[model samples]
Target: MTTFLQLHLLTAYPPSNPNRDDQGRPKQATVGGAPRLRLSSQSIKRALRVSEPFRQGLAGHMGQRTKLMAKVLLDRLLAGGMDAAQARTKAEEIAKVFGKIEPQDKKRPEAVQGTTLAFISPDERAFALDLADKALAGEALPTDKELARTVLRTADGAVDIAMFGRMLADNPDFNRDAAVQISHAITTHRAQAEDDYFTAVDDLQRREDTGGAHLGEHGFGSGVYYLYACVNCDLLVENLGGDKELAARGLRSLVRAIATATPSGKQNSHAHHPRAGYVRAEIGGAAPRDLTGAFFTPVRGDDLFDASARALERTAADIDRAYGPAADAVETMDVPKGQGTLAAIEDFAASALERQNA
Candidate 1:
């Protein structure tokens, strides 16, 4: 049996484009013929990874998802009293192990960027930098294979790397497969794009200058989103090098972030700092299931936020009743006002996850 951890969350966002389409409107998808607002899985994951609570949980055990590999390496070398020009050159060689370098200057001066943001942890970067320093000092360096092993090895691939995984195109052998799956969040009801038309008055505007100095329109919308994510605990542990304890801790942090982190889109205007009004947690060795079917017919109500959450809860109950319980342990955190609190949900999830490894 494969252990799985799953969450169904309902979050309400105001008239703001947290996730936008190419046209700058709230992202939307046609669901069952009705257009529904959407927040992409990529956006949601990035937000959670950078959230304050999530970062605090992982502490310094985090990877830098940046293209600035040369800069990172050069910083280390320069700190060790190496000359700037030499450090830049060596950094390029070291960075080549990870991916292609996009030198900042067309003249190929010094600074370089990785092909993409390679998700390498701080320790891994340090190791690679040290290896470069040794090579520069005429010290005997390890073979290429041994050097790759030394640089790629880690305690747990850092928190973000373990959960989201990384793909080093330069060396596919070091790639870590992601054990967590995220479903793009979609609203439970139809939503239409709305535009906010406004004008900004220039401080030096004269009374004869008429209405305003600048006028433009911004797009936004509101919806109650149904978000889902699944974590294969066994695979996650394997991804973290068979550390079940660390995997469990990572699961808890992930759940907490999922419940609280809102993508920092146009927050100054929308201010969408929403927590899940409801979360249904399922922990089992059974196959994970998503309750997106609950909104196939669209839930309509005067109070859509509460209605959306209620609809999800009803669907989960209906499925369990008909399918004879699809999970080993299931818990629902009804976090609407007096029903429960976010803290309570986090506690419930943590306790339940702890039981899985035990």
Candidate 2:
């Protein structure tokens, strides 16, 4: 039986633009017939992957997502004393194993980059570099197929790649399906972005200077946001090549990152780093379901966080009443009430791996 782990979080931000739209204003979504500040799943997942907790916990088991694979390989080959022309050609050949190469710019003819970003695991990166060294040493270059087969991996010990998955347009067989699904966080209550206008004074201004050196305006919003995520535990383990221990550790790190990590939009201007006020974790063989419906009507109260928490609980209870229990086990960490600790939540989520193994 396939097991699923679901997490719901309520976090409040104060006067910050953690995510922005094309206009450089805070992203917004219409929910329950009202506008609400929004945070994209892409931004949230990036934040989680780069979070300190994930870095410390996963360490070497992380991957790099970039279009500069060719550039990196070219630099390494050149540094190894290979001819520049030969290095660029070798780098481009190896890079094509991952994705299509971008056309060389006339101004920066030596620079090489992929047309699309490729998520390269550390092991895969090392393999590519090793291949480059072999070629530099006069070894016959392998075909693109051979290079990809030797360099590409489903996960390659990269927990982030295993969790978030990656797609290789040229080599679809090497692509891994995402084991986790994240929802765009939306404010539980109707909220609109407000503009903040300010001026920066010239540090070396003469006494005669009356006006400021620079002026700008940016948008920010404050509200309690409800976020949802579901993990296919079975797929996660499979993606990790059945390394249950690593999967368990990954779950713990993921929980911590989800709870503590905030999107890095305009943090320098508005340091709105707030932890999740409430968290609910569930694991079971039953099909996964998100509790986004809880805020379909949009929560309202003097204490928005408290009200949002209660609404989430109420929604879960209502769902249970309607469809029976959706999870065999559930754990929560309510920061405001001090009812549970993050450590306890982490243990609870990781315990699913044990159950699966048994």
Candidate 3:
């Protein structure tokens, strides 16, 4: 049985803020009149990393690396005897077939030396050409070109499915739905309060305008979290078993999987917000201070191992607690014997908390 599971997280921001605001004060908020640690976008991103299938999967395994698109094309074109300018032009055409390229620089020219490419859109053609110049100079190819191809082929379909495959291979039975739920929980755990207080442009000419607030109610707080998840139901059914009851039990696992965090950086680097959220730690009666600095935290080698352990323990427990009753309730549903078994399993899952309580 692929009983082992885990979710790893790297804070999107620094742990705490070192700088203070004007009047030597740090930003803070009171939750229930008690200090709720101010959280940064990094903190939420890290917490959600383990549960996000796309991120978690790509983190450990090889992804569809387009970094070599330009290099590969360049080499092929050169082999066919094309000049640097002609090579880039032809290579660019081939690249379009695969994916869009970005913009290039004019003033600061890039050295079009070796096979090099940067993944970009049509609008970013300029950047793509610029990066290609550097790529050519180094004559370096992406380390895992083949691996990237394999993943990208699938990305062409349900991108999350390929992503989930990688995540499942690493986590076994991990599913996309579960990962999403977890992300939602982490994201909604605490909402930021808008700073609606009026700013005193001048004491006598105070205006009724919000000050130092984020966009959309709270700046840097509200926005779509472009989440990517992949789920392998077959893998899940295998671990859980063909028995309807057993399959039903899998729902809990699914929920937990969705709740796990996905890693950041690399493929996931651009997944989160430029500025996510943060958590502040306060000492004594002092105000809360922001902890995170960056948008996402990079996973360390040690974190890879620790993340698995943590994901398994939490996901397993979450499944058991979240699915028991749901599984039992499945029995009440109208269905054939085999189907009923599945229903029972689902019902039992509904009472997941009861099982954990037991």
Error of 3 at 332 (Å): 24
Query: lDDT per residue, candidate 2, 1-358, as tens digits?
Result: 8888999999989999999999999999998798999999999999999999999999999999999999989998899999998899999999898899998899988778999989989999999989888987889778878888888887669999999999999999999999999999999998999999999999899989899899999999999999999999999999999999999999999999999998999999988889998999999988888888889898887998998999899999999999999999999989889889889999999998877744
What does candidate 1's lDDT look like per residue over 1-358, in tens digits? 6777788998887788888888888888989899888999999999989987678887776788878877877787787778887777777767766778875686866556776878888778888878877855766556667767778754464877888878887778888888889999999999888899999999888878878888999899888899999887767777777776667667778888998897788888878888887887887776678999999878897988788877887888898898767677777777555575666556655554455655
TM-score of each: 0.91, 0.97, 0.29
lDDT string, candidate 3, 248-355, tens digits:
333443333333332332223124423211111111111111111111221124433233223433443464465432121112211211222323333343343233
Predicted structure 1, TM vs. truth: 0.91
Which sections of candidate 1 miss by over 4 Å?
78-86, 154-157
Candidate 1: pairs in clash: none
Order of quality (lDDT): 2, 1, 3
C-alpha positional error of residue 245 in candidate 2 after TM-score superposition, expressed in Å:
0.8
User: How many collisions per candidate?
Assistant: 0, 0, 89
Give the distance in Å from residue 95's predicted Cα in candidate 2 to where it truly belongs.
Answer: 1.2
